[model samples]
Target chain A: GIQVEQSPPDLILQEGANSTLRCNFSDSVNNLQWFHQNPWGQLINLFYIPSGTKQNGRLSATTVATERYSLLYISSSQTTDSGVYFCAVDRTLYGNNRLAFGKGNQVVVIP
Target chain B: EPEVTQTPSHQVTQMGQEVILRCVPISNHLYFYWYRQILGQKVEFLVSFYNNEISEKSEIFDDQFSVERPDGSNFTLKIRSTKLEDSAMYFCASSEDGNTEAFFGQGTRLTVV
Candidate 1:
């Protein structure tokens, strides 16, 4: 099984601030996704970057597959961004497609 | 955009009782999954279904738990005997294939007493 670990378990940021969240995996993965669990408990997909870099609006993510690490960047954050951000991965060796999830980074963006 | 939809946003059941959580994934998606998240805990994978059969499951998905695609547009997770620990937000997800981005539903909050 692949282990997914996230850093900065807790974060409090002022609105308009910027933050970076990191995710490290123990093994190579073919499927990696970033999700935001909102206050209401709806899991929203932020990015799907198994490798390389991708940007969506004020949020962007970069994954260095060779190093087994991924980074998510949130710029000019807003209060709506307050929630738990999770990183999930599925190992390349197994095609089961079950994602191993990180504990998540709880972010609180205060206005 | 098409999104996964789950029924009975919240369910309350007595321990030792049976409960069935239902979900309707995107029409074109082929892979379906069920994940659980305990209060203040991370999401954990329970099972994945494809081609109308179970593809993979975790240790947490014991004999008490089962999944079925009873129809073309519906996927379900049934627990034979609910336990206190079974209380959690159960999320149903789907992807086009084994190697694609998966989308999750709003989730069903199950409370077992």
Candidate 2:
């Protein structure tokens, strides 16, 4: 099993601010992703970056598979972005892509 | 953009009762999974299904828990006998390929009394 730890378990930022949330895994992984769990308990896919960098609107993510780490960046954050961000990894080939998830970074974008 | 759909937005049952949580993954998806998150807690993987059998499962997925794809569009998780600890928001997700990205449904909140 792979262990995952997220930094700054909780974060509070203004609507227009920028922030970076990090995810550190215990070992190499075949796949990685960032997800936002909204107030309605919906897990929205934000990024699927096993390695390299990708950006989408105000959200971006970077993963260094070799180093076993990933980062999610939010710029000019909005109130709607407030939710728990989770970084998950696929460490093995079995189980329909069984992913080990991090505890998550709880973000609050205050208006 | 394809999205997974789940039924019974919320469900409540007694500790010793049985409950089935249903999900319909994207029509073209081949892999399906179920994860649970206790209120204010981290999301935990329960099991994954592929090729009509379980590909993998976590320790939490015990004898009391089972998953099935009884029809073409539905994947279900049935708790043979619910327990208080089973109360949580259960999320169903699917991916076109096991190596690609996954899309999750809104989730079914299960409350066991």
Q: How displaced is residue B100 in candidate 1, in Å?
A: 0.8
When summed lDDT is taken over every stretch of 10 residues in candidate 2 chain B, the lowest stretch is B95-104
TM-score for each predicted model, relative to the true structure: 0.98, 0.97
lDDT of 2 by residue, B18-104 (tens): 999999999999999999999998888999899888988999999999999999999999999999999999999998888788888
Model 1 residue A17 CA deviation (Å) reads 0.6
Candidate 1 per-residue lDDT over residues A3-82, each given as its tens digit? 99999999999999999999999999999999999999999999999999999999999999999999999999999999
Q: Model 1 Cα displacement at A111 (Å)?
A: 1.1
Q: For residues B33-89, what per-residue lDDT tens digits would candidate 1 score against the true structure? A: 999999999999999998889998899999999999998899999999999999999
Give per-residue CA lDDT, model 2, range A1-111, as digits (tens).
789999889999999999999999999888899999888888899999999999999999999888889999999999999999999988765446888889899999999
**What lDDT does model 1 reach?**
0.95
Query: What TM value does the first chain of each candidate achieve?
Result: 0.97, 0.96
